[model samples]
Target: MLFDTHTHLDAPQFDEDRDETIARALEAGVSRMINIGFNRETIPTTMKLAETYDFIYAAVGWHPVDAITMEEGDLEWIASLCSHEKVVAIGEIGLDYHWDTSPKEVQHRVLRSQIGLARELHMPIVIHNRDAHEDIVKILKEEKAHEVGGVMHSFSGSWETAKLCLDMGFHISFGGPITFKNAKQPKEVLAKVPLDRLLIETDSPYLTPHPFRGKRNESAYVKLVAETAAEIRGMSFDELVQITTKNALERFGIS
Candidate 1:
């Protein structure tokens, strides 16, 4: 079974046929999915989805783009939700230089705070890094995030960077970009990641895989990401599925 470890199923793009999208994922052999709650607005929706579906889980945090908007109460609320049966991790949290919606200093502060929260709670974190690799890695190390470990969602960095994250006890997760024809970095990173530390995600309602590019993404398309990852690693598709599914469960502490 495949596990889409990071997705935005709560995004409005899936509102039209969310049920059908989830059903398609199950039919496509995606046995589990983690809906990422990246902002206050999506946190309740994410939790609701997890509560409503046995196979869905949740990870809550403030996205770096919205870092400036996060208030103290929001952090407290996220911490409170961590004990929920369906909440699996603290994430979709990290630095994003691409959008710059939030100032770098604020993003850094928020990222560190959440990382500290995850450590205090003894929970794994799900990171989202974009165009701010060095600082992100530095902050994680400074915070000693290796204590709780986590997944680097939708990784798009050099093998050197991946090695650093792996050394810090972070799993490397790949998404739709790996299937893109011109995505050299992701392909290179895929070749270098150890199978045991590898994971797959769709980041759905976004990053749709090849052949389905430019269209709305959903969890069912994780199969294509797995297929491409398997090919890149020269492993059988079934083997890739089994290995990544195991990795996801291990990373998330799922049974």
Candidate 2:
């Protein structure tokens, strides 16, 4: 069995054939997936995916890019959603410097608030950090995020940065970028991250792996991430799948 610790299966890109994509994933050995919601708007779809697909779980939160426009009741309402049995965590939340979607200060404040809410809810988080590694690590440290461990979804950082997140109890999740020729940084991180802290994902319809790169990705392709992680760790594909699946379940409170 395999687990896709992070994936935006709720994204509009899957609107045409979401069910087909999910069936493909199941056939490809992805036994479990966490449908990541990036903002207030994405939460309903995320929850619906979880309700519709027994194997699909839900993670809801405001992304760094969309944190600015979220209304007052959004966080409170999203927090309330955590009470649902299918909801596993609070996330897809963090800092993103790759795009200037909002002022840095606003993103930082929103992230801080979400961090606190996740802690209060006692749920793991699914983090997304881009060019803002320093700030991401700083806020995680400042917020005492270790108390609520989560996965560093689509992790792309140096061993030093990976170490910081690992030290603070975050799992290092590798995605399609790890299979890219120019992705030296994530590759380096893949080689160094301990087996237990390792997780894999496709980040579907976004970072499709090598064999399917540039095409719309789905959870079925998660094995590609597992295959790549196996090569990085000098282990077999089955072993990688087992360890990562265990890690994903532990963090998300899944069976």
Candidate 3:
């Protein structure tokens, strides 16, 4: 079985045929997926999806891009939802310098606060790093996030960065980008990560894999990500799937 560790199934893109999309995922052997809740509107929808589908789980938090909109009650709301049986982690959270939609300072503050909340709740976090590696790693270290280590979702960093995150007890997760033809850095990083710390995701409704790059993505396509990862690591596809599925389950504390 494959575990798609990061996805945005609640996004409007799937409204037309969400049920069929989910059915395709199961038919494609993607037995589990973590649907991200990155803002106020999506959190409840994320919970509803998890509650409705036995195989779907949720990771709730605010995205750095929406940092300006986050309020104190939002943190409390996220914390309260952590008690739900289907809520698995505290993220899609981290810094995003590429967009700079939120001021760097505000992003930093929100990121730290959520990290603290995750620590308090004893839940793993799913991080989203984009062109802000140095500060993200620094904040994670300063915050001592190793206490409840999590996955660095859709990792696209150097092996050195991966080593640092691994040292800090974070699992390295790869998404559809790993399957792109021109994705040299992700391919190199894929080889360097230990199999035990490797994971796979689709980031669906986005980052579609090769041969389907411009189309809408879905959890079913996670198998393509796994196939590419396996080829890069020179392992059998089944072996890669098994290892990553195990890693995902353990990272999210899933049985």
Candidate 4:
């Protein structure tokens, strides 16, 4: 079995063939998926997808780039959704220095609030850190995120950063980037993560893996990510899939 622990199947990119793509993923052995809803618009669509598909799950939070748009009521909305049976995590949240759409201060405040909410609700979080490793680690520490340890989605940080997340009981997930030849750091970090804490994802409609790098990504392509991860850890493909699937299930508390 395979689990794409993160994805965005609700993205407009798949508007024409979303069901077909999901069917392909199942055929390729993806037994479970978590669709991320990072803002006001996507959250409802994501919830709809989860409600429609038994194998699909949801993660709702305000994205760092959209942090400026998060009003007080928005936080309450996310909190309300946390009670939904299909909502497994509070995330796709964190700092994103790469995008200047939202001020750094706003991103920090939003991330801190989400972390607090997750901790208060006793739910794991899914972090989306981009080009702000140091600040992300600092905020997560200050917020005491270890109380609700989560996944470092599409982790592209150095081994040192990975080590810190690992110390906080976070799972380091690799995506399409790891399948790239020049992705030396992610490859190295993947090798170092403990097997039990390892996870894999597609970040679908984005980070499409090698041989399909420039095209739109889908959950089926997570097999490519799984194969690359297996190669990095020097384990059989089936073994890696079993470990990561189990890790994903337990991490999300999926039955």
Candidate 5:
């Protein structure tokens, strides 16, 4: 069995065949997946997906790219969603400096608020760091995010950043990027991360893996990520799947 620790199966990219896409994932050995809702628009669709599929789960939070859009009571909206049994985590929340759509200050505040909410709820968080490594780690540290650890979704940082996150009790997750031919840093980071702290994902409808690169990603393609991860760690494919699946279950408190 496999667990796609993070994904965006709710994206409009898959609206035409969402159910079929999920079926393909199951057929590819994906037993569980966490669909992220990073904004006001996606959250409801994500919850609908989680409620529909027994194997699928939900993570609700704000995305850094749209941090400027968050209004008063948005944090409370996310908090209230956490009470849902299928709402397994508070995340896909972090700093994203590359987009430049949201001001850094706004992004930081929104991230801090979400992290604070997660800590208050005693729930794990799923982070989305992009071009703001130092600030991400710094904020996480200041917020004492270690008290309720979470996954660094689709981690693209160096060993040093990974180490800091690990020290803060976070699990480092990899996605389709790891399967690329020239993804040197991610490969090295994956090889060095402890098996217990390792997880995999698709971030689907995006980050499509090798052989399928340049195409839209899907949860079904997570098998390609698992295969690559196994090769990188010098372990059997089955073993990698087992270990990562267990880690995901524990990290997200799925059971």
Candidate 6:
């Protein structure tokens, strides 16, 4: 079994053949997937997809790029959504200074708010950190995010930073980027982190690994991510899949 811990299947990119893609994944033993929500519009789609597929689970929140339009009632709204059977976590939320879609202050304000929502709802969080790692670490610490420990999805930071998140009880998730031939930092971190502390994902529709690097990624390709992790840790691919899937289940509370 394999778990795709972070993916934006709600995006229009999957509209063409979402069912087929998901079917391929399940057929290939990629049975569970975390479909992340990234704004007001996607919350419903994410939930709907989760309801449609037995293996799909969801995390609802605003991505930093789209956090601007949320009003006061929105956090409450997300809280209510978290009560649903399909909702597993709170996020796709956090800082992203790489793109100036919104101001840093605005991102911080919204990120903190969502983090609070996750805490209030007693759910884990799925964080997205771009060039704003320093501030991300700061906000996570200030909010005491360890209370609802979750993943730093698509982590691109150093082992020093990785250790900081680990200290806070956060699991580090690596995606297709870790499979890149030249992705030295992520590979190094992959080798050093204990298996219990690591998770693997495809982050599909983006970050596709080598041999399929420029193509559209899906849950089915999560095998490449697992294979890469296996190579990095010098373990068998089957063993890597077994352990990471367990890691994802523990993190998301999936049975």
Q: Write the per-residue lDDT of candidate 1 for residues 188-222, one digit (tens) a residue.
A: 99998998999999999899999999999999999
Candidate 2: segments with Cα more than 4 A from true spot: none
Cα misplacement distance, residue 203 of candidate 3 (Å): 0.2
**Residues 135-195, model 3: lDDT tens digits:** 9899999999999999999998888899999999999999899888899999999999988
What TM-score goes with each of the models? 0.99, 0.98, 0.99, 0.99, 0.99, 0.98
- Candidate 3 has a TM-score of 0.99
Candidate-wise lDDT, in order: 0.94, 0.90, 0.94, 0.96, 0.94, 0.89
Residue-wise lDDT of candidate 2 within 129-222, one digit each (tens)? 9899899999999999999989898988889999999999999998999898889989888888888898899888889999889898889999
| Native-to-model Cα distance after best TM-score fit, residue 106 in candidate 5, in Å | 0.4
TM-score of 4: 0.99
What is the C-alpha lDDT profile of model 5 across 1-255, one tens digit per residue?
999988899899988999899999999999999999999999999999999999999999999998999999999999999999999999889999888899999998999999889989999999999999999999999999999999999999999999999999999999999988899999999999999999999998899999999999999999999999999999999999999999999988877
Model 6 Cα lDDT, one tens digit per residue, 1-255 = 989998878778899998898889988889799998888888899899899888899999989988678788988889998988889999889999888888888999999999888888889998999987789999999998999989999989999899989988899999999988889999999888878978988888999988899999888888889988998899999999999989999888888
lDDT of 4 by residue, 67-170 (tens): 99999799899999999999999989999998789999999999999999999999999999999999999999999999999999999999999999999989
The deviation in Å at residue 102 for candidate 1 is 0.5
**Greater-lDDT candidate between 2 and 4:** 4
Instruction: Go through the candidates in order and give the clash count of each.
Output: 0, 0, 0, 0, 0, 0
Task: Report the Cα lDDT for candidate 1.
Answer: 0.94
Backbone-clash count (model 2): 0
Q: Top model by lDDT, which number? A: 4
lDDT at 237 for candidate 1? 97
